[model samples]
Target: MMKLYKKYQSLIKISFFIIIFLISNNCNSQNKYEILKSKIENISQNSTDNSKSSIEIIEFLSYMCHHCTAIENILNQWQSSIPADVILIKIPICSNKKSEVLQKLYLTINEINKPYLHCELFHMFAKEKKSITHIKDLNDWLISKNINVKEFLELYNSFYIQSKSNRANQLAKLCRIKGIPTFVVGGKYTTSPAIAGDEYECTINTINYLIEKIRKE
Candidate 1:
């Protein structure tokens, strides 16, 4: 009877340690992301559709931001491998006149269906150290790309582009986005290199962790 009691006690001790280990891992996982509150409440509240099963990962970035440029390549690579159920949306921060122009540039690129120009614009800004504070700065470059300057300018100044640029700015303000290269994962968690760690890869891991966490839920 004493032998059986000792065996039972040993099993209890082993189970207790296993439980502690699992709990520790879970805590560590949860520490990777921050549970957002008002910063992202509008995203959920304003969501008009429930039929969508795909997860959204919103990246708040600016072409003029050095950190955004630094992480662009890694982000692009990650986007290529993301699951079909995940959607990545990039919202350019339009806080100032220069950034607002860049934001319209992005919208105009989308409007004209010139997706490749996104990378070219980034390359020009980051690699060439070029500054495009005004819309006219792009006139020469646009012509070089064989893009019709008149049509592009018309689209850039159109009411549709203006509305989108204003909306982007308003969304940034609503989310209280104070820094570039920040990411909102599944609209429930917010993480960035500054929030996760100095290493860009840590931000990516945190993003992936949040994505998997949302998927499980």
Candidate 2:
């Protein structure tokens, strides 16, 4: 009886060690972003577009959110490296005035197709330490950028900007976004680099993982 009990104990210990070893090895193969991707991809499926043909990357963000401001560089770099086939999207938050300002800023620059100017807006506001509380500030900044002040204002106050702002707010609600810098992959799942398993790395990894998963599907 004693010999049999010893054999059972040895077997249990070996099994436990084997399980631990496998998990450790797997962890070694994984990155933080990969973990976030795995969490989402495990529950992935086809939805809106009806075939799961492409991966949807939505950066749900607000300019007023300092953390989002900080991570903008990372997103910018990640976006540049991504291929053209991926459906990249940005939803500017519009829950309040600050968010509203940011969204309007987005549409205004987009309206003119001045992407370079669009890219500089955030740096102007966050890095240069400028206060963007009113139209004058934005107007002055645009003028400084050599953007036609009158034309910009005409669009700024136009019904188009208002409609776009409302749409942004509605889209945000639909996505269930309550914070800045939240990201949703494929519209079925949402997370933040801060709240997700990994911060910015999660965003990049989610893109990579979904790219692989979609290719497989």
TM-score of each: 0.79, 0.70
Off by over 4 Å in 1: 1-29, 39-51
TM-score of 1: 0.79
lDDT of 2 at 186: 60
| Candidate 1 lDDT (Cα, 0 to 1) | 0.79
Worst 10 residues of 2 by lDDT: 34-43
Check candidate 2 and list the clashing pairs: 193-199
User: What is the C-alpha lDDT profile of model 1 across 4-117, one tens digit per residue?
Assistant: 999999999999999989755644535656776653433322235441566778899888887898888899999999987677888887766778888888888888998888
What clash pairs does model 1 have?
none
lDDT of 2 at 64: 63
